[model samples]
Target: EGRRRGSRAEGGAAFETARCPLPPAVPDLLGRDAELARLRAEAAADAPGGVVVSIVGHPGVGKTTLAVSAAHELASRYPDGSLAVDLRGTDDRPLSPRAALEQLLGALGLPARQIPASEPEQSQLFRSLLAGRRVLVLLDNAADEAQVRPLIAAAPGCLTLITCRRALAGLETARWVWLDPLEAPAAADLLSVIVGPDRVLAEPEAATELVALCGNLPLAVRIAGNRLATRPNWSIAYLAGQLRDERTRLSSLSAGDLQVRSAFEMSYGLLSPSARRVFRRLAAIPGSGFGPELAGVAAGMSAAEVQVRLDELVDVNLVQAAVIPGRYQLHDLLRIFAGERLEAEEEAAERSARSEELLSYLLRTATIAGRAFDPPVLTAHPFASLDEAAEWLYREASNWRAAQRRAAAAGRHREVVDLAIAMHWYSDGRTQQQPWDEIFALGAESARALGSRREEAALLNFLGWARYFCLGDNEGGRAAHEAALALAVEIGDRTEQAWANASLGSVLTRMGRPEEALEHARRAVDLSGDLPFWLGQGSIRNVLGTILRVLGRPGEALEVHRGLLADIEKHYDEAHPFARRFFHSATLQCIGLAQNETGDWPRAAETFRRARELFGEGGNALEEADAALNEGRARREAGQYEAAAECLRAALRGFTGVAAWWPRARALAELSTVHWLTGDAAAARRYRDEALALCEELGTPQARALACELA
Candidate 1:
């Protein structure tokens, strides 16, 4: 009958139904009757509205098999024919959204030359073709939400069924059906269907154990069944016992070319050499997931190139896209398989070289990102925009931080010290009360290992600031700074000595030793005077001014800030707007704090407003929020309740968005006070409770004290 139909079609080419390009119907799909029935019901119920059913599961739970079975059963009902595409959601070369659309349009009888190149235009034409037609579109193995969203049947009287490892959370309209491993009864039934039912019934208990040993997963079961069917003499009990060992389970599941490892290898083999290297080395990443930028550094490739490879990996199901947009992860089993490949395929020296490349990239790139937060020095800025720098710092935090540990293990002491030196100022604000204490401690150890007194002194100086500001360990901070001062004096590094003195002054002030703090602040200023270090003088003076304000000497603090502002303006260059804005904004914020302390409410508010503008332009969200917080406090002091609440709310939003916990807590506390002043007791209590919870969670003494005061 098929031969007669082929001959007739050849004679009457015009009468053939344009050859629906659906793949051959799946030969046998056992124990999925309910799933198929659900799809049929959805397709029938969703007439004229269009139905999109997503069959999501882990690797090889038979997603493609189930979709194909449903398509074959429901094809006759849709008179307009069906279209099936292997979007290769898990392929190394997944089809692009645009290309997928073009293929679908071509299947709909559109000519190649007439199809639009742009995605939007192609989508419009596709929807037009699908309109008023009861066609079924089966999109198998979707890579991510973005890849499948465009292919969804746009008009009613159609159905689009997609299968993928990920949940594709971004696809809002699609009804999701999550598939797990088959149950014991169903698993045995499937095994029987594949390898003769009589053979399975002959040893029922052994068949049940065999299915369980296969993890009740359809793919494993099918392979096991195929292997047994070919070897007619092999007993079911013998095969089940062979797969009992966990280590050799993957090996035992395979018979010929049909293998779990081979399916994984097919995806891996399609990768470019660079991408393959990245995929295998990714086993070294300690966490479950990572972004492409970090993967790029590990692979020694550009971020753009790594992103394309990541898309390919996602398409083939070797990697899964995370809920966080840029992050990707491997399944636990796949991760182990990748590690096996890395050990077998890569030499020890090659692995070490890859580690070195990753470490060096992290140290260099992190230093560049970190320096963007510092007051302008004479050094060239590595990043073109502060926004780019901030994003890099946030997104790649895990990669660079992990690299620091790896560097320490490899004895790359000098790079470790230099990396931490760059983070000195940036860490103070960005990670205040975060885990920067351990980072600085590592830097100090690295410096000591190199036997460089100057580097040791510098690391110790930064370590003191981290202990005092971030860890709230005043004793540790004083001890570290004193050691740094001793080392600097012994080495005749006057610049480092001055920086150490300035750091000690800040620590002593926080420790309630005002007179001692004043002495150190004066020495820091005196020592910095003759230093040729570009940022030294202003850095020490800023510390001096801050101490004076802390000691109730606001008038002197104001004078010192005014002098520091003038010096910054004197050196400011119009061509280097980042440097200019960086210096000016910090100075303005300090001046605002000084004015607020002196009871000059209006001047403080105005200064804070100007600082906020500069920080906003520079893309310093944390600093911008700081200015807003200060302005809110000044307005509150002036009894401008409404204005104060508005400023505090804006500050809270910014701080919350960036996850700056300590400052977010502070903003919440301040906002509570503003609400209290405005007689909104409910709002005040709500904000106060949030602040108290955050303070308690962090276990910071200063934050706790502030929270108590609010209570």
Candidate 2:
């Protein structure tokens, strides 16, 4: 890092290059002979006077020791005494310029009365005193640029060295140096200092192994070395005993005057109690990053208070202030510490209850916001907290999933049994709502946990329908529906009973069991009237239309769709919250198909157009594509050749799956007629073959006839 950034100073005492001293005593920095030589050379060169050098890296990386060593080596060149200030940049009470300069001036034997009161006057006085006298100013544990800037003595004879846990890039005058982990040989050398050089030299392999376990962090290694240095009776192999235990691995980093936690605790203890409380709770948050809004939620504090606490944590190096914007995270080491404290500091039962409440709050919020996203239903247990609930779900989607997973793993069977019930809207909202797979797995797990035939049956039935219709997973669709049917029979829940019947009917229809599917649809309709109208009435009626159309009873299907359409129009406006949902759009598509099958081509075209418009509103690519295919089919049958050509081109662009391909092929065959009628035989022939291939591929006899006619 020194070579990367430091400019080489010309001849003269490099220490005259104006360096700062670190604290009075610092040991355990060894094996940087080549590194120290480079720094010493830069310090000697007089290319630029008043140069500020900063030492920066992760904690326990030996930045202070290197800076302090350089400061002591440079002491002889400066007749005036060197000054060391613990700026505490990452800690609370970043040493203010007034306090630091007062200490520096007083240390040099200047009377307290002689020092100026304000920051500017004191800065000038300090510079005046050090003007001709060569001095080294080592600002140790410096916080940030704002803390260190005022303390810079403006004399060419004074060299300034600042050490911090972070790169003080904000200080324009500072040359940056990074204190990375000591290398293996260097760490071994550091270990030698604790256990004598000869002992480490004898067991180089063990020494190498020890450093690897240390993560090459100076703080952790020093603790290991200290254990060996003080306890001569403890063998190197015996020290390795404690190291083998994962639980107590970081324990080695604990001892008198040198502990990672103690260092952390000292900084933590300095915080206001409120900040400490917020600090620990922040660990309970699930994501790797969080916004201030989430921090506000986790702390149950005001936005202003959360920001203040965040700043406090950043100042003390407990939390890193997110550099991008509106985010924060604990460092890995600090995260471990904070997590441990969260569990230990709070009663286990109390923490567990709070976690449950937080998870319930998230589930309730997600369901509400999801409903509001399109208000498709008034589920029996609709969420009460609307606005606040929506806001929370929008913020903590990931946390809710993590919580759901954690609950399931802990054998909290009840939680597992019903987590997906809380998140029902996830699958219902369609594939665009990402987190669908997670919601499905959670709901399935919850059903497994409950082992209640009724709940399991309902979940299986509903989840199966969603997978088949939305995700288009045929195997999952079949298995889930089968499970629902068997469980519904076992539970005897009439609503789920009818739902299971309808679910099997649809999957069976997709599997080409039209006759059997027609029987199930009939059974679903028979059971529908005894249940709630909204629960299965609309669905069963649609199923009836589907079966009738398959039986070539277009007249009956058209009549069913017409009546359902009237009910929808009479009870709800176009902007009715639920009417705007994708479910309503799907119903509209069935209505359009019924009309087209019954020979009301104009009405079919209009209904398809309306459905397409509705899907477009939500940017639902899949729905819009299906609607385009239907509108094209209606246009083709209406003998609107030019219009049909336009519609089919759009359908091809928008359609996705098998259903779409069949309609699109029919439209293509019709469009070839348009070409043949317009005296473009070559274009007609090309389109005819394309349509034939699609028909053969999809096994559409009706479309194949049109292709053959065009040929």
The candidate that achieves the highest TM-score relative to the unseen native structure: 1
Q: Tell me model 2's lDDT, rounded to 2 decimals.
A: 0.63
lDDT of 1 by residue, 190-236 (tens): 89988899999999999998886666778767767766786789889
lDDT (10s digit) by residue, model 2, range 410-435: 66656655556654543343332234
- Candidate 1 CA-lDDT value: 0.73
The runs of at least 3 residues in candidate 1 whose Cα sits more than 4 Å from the true structure, single-residue gaps closed, are 1-184, 189-281, 284-317, 323-327, 345-396, 422-429, 432-435, 531-534, 574-576, 592-711
Candidate 2 regions with alpha-carbon error over 4 angstroms: 1-276, 293-303, 314-334, 341-357, 363-391, 409-419, 434-453, 550-553, 569-577, 580-585, 595-603, 613-621, 645-711
lDDT of each: 0.73, 0.63
C-alpha RMSD (angstroms) for model 1? 17.9
